[model samples]
Target: MPFSSSSSSSSSSSSPDSKYNLTSAIRAQTQFLTHAYTSHNLVIASYMKNMDNQPPRHEGSTFGHRVIHCDREEADRRLWNDYFSEYPKYSEAMFRRRFRMSRNLFIRIANVVKGHDNYFVQRNDRIGRLGLSTLQKVTAAFRVLAYGIPADEYIQIGESTTIESLKRFCRAIVDVFGERYLRAPDANDVARLLQIGEKRGFLGMLGSLDCMHWTWKNCPTAWAGQYAGRSREPTIILEVVADYDFWIWHAHFGMPGSNTGINVLEGSYLFSNLANGIAPPCHYVIQGQQYHTGYYLADGIYPKWSTLVQTIHEPRGPKKKLFAMMQEACRKDVERAFGVLQSRFAIVKGPTRFWDKCVLHDMMSSCIIMHTMIIEDERDEQADIQGWKEAPTPEVDIARDENIIFQEFLARHRQIKDKEAHYALCNALIEHLWE
Candidate 1:
C-alpha cells in the first residue's frame, strides 16, 4: 500500500513540470510571430516613404491656359452692343449668309434659349472671370451648323463647351418650334395641300417621298455592321416627305444604312395614320372617278400601295413616257429639299461626328424645323412683295355625300394592300397626263 502511494505522488509532481514547459514554448512562438509581422510592416512603410520623396517622372500637359488676346474686351463690347443693338458690324445680307438667318431671328432665338435654360446664360467662371456671352455661345452653335468647322477654330470657347452649346441649341429649337414645324397635317393643311396638288395637275397628290443617307464617321466598331452597307461606309438614313415649296412635312431618321428606302417606308409613320383609320380625309376626282386617299410620288423601290404613285419602269408608249416624266420631275421635290437642307446646314452635308444616334437625330430635326421656318418667312415676304392675295373662296368641284364618302374611305382602306388598285391608278394617271 505504501509503495503504491509513493508512485502516485511522484507522477502528480511531474505533470506540473510538463504543463509549465508546454505553456512556455507556446508563449515564445506567439512572441516570434508578432515580431516578424511588425518587421514586415515597417519595411513596407519605409518603401512607401521613399516613394513619396521621389520626383515625378512624367507630367501631363495642362490645357485651357489663358491665351493672350489684345482686343478681347473690345470684341466682346462690339458683339454685345454694336451687333446686338441698333448699330451692327454686319449687314442683314451678311448676317443671313454667315448664320443662315437674319439678325432679328438670331436675337430672337438667342433670347428664347437664354430664357429657357441657365446654361445659355453667361455666368462667372470658377476663378470669378466672366464666361462666354449668350451671343458667343449661340454663334458658336450656328458656326458649327454653317461651316461644319471644329468649334475651337472660330471661337475662344473650349471644344467641349462648344459641343455642349450646339447640343443645347438644337434641343431648344426643337422644344420651341417642334410642335408647329414637325406636326402632322391638320384639316386645313390637308385642304391647302390638296388645292396645291390640284393646281399642279395632280388632283390628289400630297408630296414626294424620298430617302437620303448621312455618312457617320464616328460609328462605333461594334455597330459598324449594322450601319455600314453596300455604300462600303457607315451611314444613317433619313426618310423625308417634302412638298413643292421645299418644306419638309415628315422626317423619319436613324435607320441603319443597311436598310433601303422601302424598308424605311414599311416602318414609317406615313402609313400609321392610314392604318389606324385616322388619316385626314382627301377626296379628289380624276377622269370622273373619285379617290378618297391622297397619294405620294415615290421612286421604284416603294411598294405598290394605293396611296403611292411610282414612275413607270422603262416606259415605251408616249402616254407612259409622259407620265413617267411628270412623276419623276415631281418626285425630285423631296430631293431638292434634301439638297437645300444640306446646303443650309453643312453639319448635315459632311459626315456626322457624334457617337450617339439621339444627338444626330436632334440635330437633323432642328435643321429641318429651321429650314421650314425660313421657307415660310421667305414665302410670306415674297407674296407681300408680289402683291399676292389669298383667294376669298375656294371652289369645290363636287360636294360629296357623307355616306358615299364613308363607303369610298372603306373601299380605299380595303385597297391599301391591293396591287391591282395601284396599277389601275397608274393607268388612269397615264391616260390623264396624256390627254
Candidate 2:
C-alpha cells in the first residue's frame, strides 16, 4: 500500500509515473465496461429465448383452445330426467310455452339432431369443460327465438355459439319436418280442404292468400332505401297461404317492403302449378255450373285472376253485402296464421336482430314449418277430443234420382287466370248466397 519509490526508480523504461498510472486506470475502466456489456447481452438473450418459447398472448382464451368435453352417457341420463321423463322438471305446458313444441315433439327433434349437434371429446387427461347439454343448447336457441333475449346472458354461452345453435336448430327443423308440414296439398288434403270450404259457404275456396311485413331491426343502412315501405320503416314481406286451421301451406318470402299485395301476388307461384296443368283436380258446383279450378279469397288489392276471389269494395244489395262479409271473414285465415306465428315465436313478432337476409328467410321458414307442425299435432288431439266417427252408411236402392250422375275428374285442368270465369263464378256465388 505504500508508494513504491524503490520500484519506480528501478523501472525507467516504464515511462513517467503519471502517464503509467493514467494508462492503468483506463485499462481497468475498459475491462469493467466490456464485462458489464457482456452480462447485459446475456440477460437480453435469455429474455428473447424465453419469449420465443412462450405461448401466444391470446392462447387458452379462444373457442378452439377452450375445450368442452362431456360424458355422453351421463349427459344423456341427465337430459332424459330433465326433459324427457314422464315426470320431468318442467310441465308440458311450460315446455310448450318455452320451446314452442310439446315435450314429445321436442324429444323427437332432439333425437334427430343429436348426432349433428354432439360436441367432440376435448380433453384426454381430464374433463376440461362440460359441453353444453342438448337441453341447454335447445333452450338457448328457444330463448333467442321466443324471447329475443341475448342467449349469451343465459347459460353463459358465447353470442357466436348461441347464433350457431340457432342456425343449426332452424336447419334441422326444416330438414326433419319441412316435407311433412310444409308440403303441397295431396288428394286427402284437397278433399278435406274442399269439405271445409263447402261447409264455410265458399264452394271452391282453397285458402286465403295474404302478405305480411316483418320489420327488419338490424337491416343495413345501405338497403334501408329499398326495404322501407309506405310505413317509412325497413320491412320484409312474407307471402303466405293459410287454411282454416291456421295451417300455412305456402310461404314466399324475401321481397322488399316497398311493394304492395298486388306486387307480391303477380310474382308469387300461387297459380304456377295450375298454369302448368299440374294442379290437383278441383271439382265444385255453384248455381248448377261446374268448375275445375279452386280459388283463394283475397283482399281488394289482389288482381282479378280467377284463382283470386276479391270482395267488392262497395256492395249494392243484401246479397253482395253478405258475400262481402263472408269473403272478408274467410280471408282472415292468413292474417290469423300470421298473428299466431308471431305470437308463438316473438322473434318474428319483434324486429329481427339478424342482419343477413338469408338468416331471416330461414327463420321465417322455420317458424312456419313449426306452426304447421303444431297445428297438425293439435288437430290430432282435437279429433280425439271430439270423438269423431265415420258416419254409418245408409241403405241404398230405395230412390234413384234422375239428377244423380257419375262425374270423372278432368284430365285437362282449366287455366286459373281466366277473368270471365272469375266473373261467372262470382255471380253464381252471389246468387247462391242470395237464395
Candidate 3:
C-alpha cells in the first residue's frame, strides 16, 4: 500500500496499472463519441419521419385555404336549373315543346335584327364594340315578358349585355311578334269573328271594348295640364277591344285625357272604319233613330251611341232590366280579357314607373300585343262557348251550367266578383234597356 517513489514509478511504467489508466482514458473518449453518435442518429430518424408524413405545400392551400373554382359547365347547369324551376308548369323539355323554338331560332332572329344593314346605315356607324349573341338578345327580350324584371337586373342576368341591347331586343321582339301576330284583322278575319259572335247570339256586336288607365311617374311640367286627372296624377290611356271569344281585335293607346273620348276614338283606324261605312249590316233602332246595325259593348263612362250598347238605367223599367243584363254580360268579356292580361303579365298590374311617355307607350303596346298572343295561345274555345245560345226562359237558370262555366273562367284567371255592385248595376241596366 505504501511504496517507494522509484518502485511506484517502475510498477506504473511496466505493470497493468499503467495500461489501466491509458485504457480508461481511451474508453471515456469512445463512450462520449458513441453517446453523441446515438443521439445524432435518433434526431436524424425523427426528422426523416416527420418529412415523410408532411404534405406538399400548394399556394392556395398554404395561406387562405383551398378554393373551389366551379367549372363553367357546372355553373351553367345550376343556373339553368334555377331558371327552369321558377316556372313550375314548364319543365325544360316542356318549354322547348310548347314554344317550338330553339337556341338557333333565337340566334337567327337576333341576327336578322342585329346585323340589319338598314339599322347600321341609319345609325351611320359600325356595330357597337360590345354585342350580345342573337340568342342572348332574344332570351333577354323574353325575360322581360316572362318576369318583368327591371332593366338593370335584366342586364345583370344577361352577363355582358348592356341596357341598350336589352331595349333593342325588346323592340325587335315586338316588331317581329307584331308583324307575325298583332296584325290588324283583314276584312275576312273581321267577317269571320263577327259571324262567330252572331252564331253565339251576340247580335250586331262588332266587339266589346273598354279603356284602362296607367299612372305615369314623370309628368312633363309643361304638359301636366294635358295629362293630369282627378286622380291628381299624370296617366296614359289604353283602349282595347275583344270579341266574344275574348280575342283582342284592336288596341289604341297613348291618348291624353285632355283629348275627349270621342276625339281619341276618332283618332283610331278602328273608328275610321266605322265612319267609312265598312261595318257589318245589322240594324237596331235606338231612341227612335234607326242606325246601321253594329253594336259595341262599353262601360257606363261612355256616352250611349246608336252603335254602342250601354247598361240599362233605373228609368228604363222592366224591359231595361233584360237589356242591362245582356249589356253587362257582353261587357264582361272585355273586363275578363283585361284581368287575364294583367294577371299573366304582371308589369301592367300596377302603375307604370317609366320616365318617358314614348317608352311607356311602347311598353303598353307591347304588353297588349303579348297579352293577345297569350290569350290566343291559352283559350279553349270549345269549352268557353259551349251551349251559350239556348233561348232564355222566364225561369232561366242563369246561375247554372254555362254561367258556372263563365265563373270558372274568371276563377281560373284569379278574378274576384264585385258581387254587390255588379248585380245592382246588372239589375238597373237590365231594367232600363228592357223598358
lDDT scores of the candidates, listed in order = 0.82, 0.77, 0.57
Number of the top lDDT candidate: 1
Residue pair clashes in candidate 1? none
lDDT of 1: 0.82
lDDT of 3 at 157: 35
Full-model lDDT, candidate 2:
0.77
Q: Model 1 compared with the native: what TM-score?
A: 0.79
Q: Who is ahead in TM-score, 1 or 2?
A: 1
* Number of clashing residue pairs, candidate 1: 0
Candidate number with greatest TM-score = 1
Q: What is the C-alpha lDDT profile of model 2 across 277-336, one tens digit per residue?
A: 556667889988988788889888776777888898899989999999998999999889
Kindly list the per-residue Cα lDDT of model 3 for residues 152-221, writing each as its tens digit.
Answer: 3332333334344545655655676767555555544545555565554454466887877677666778
After superposition, the stretches of candidate 3 with alpha carbons farther than 4 Å from their true spots are 1-135, 151-162, 258-260, 277-293, 381-435
Q: RMSD of each candidate?
A: 5.9, 13.1, 23.5
How many residue pairs clash (N, CA or C atoms closer than 3 angstroms) in each of the candidate models, in the order given? 0, 0, 16
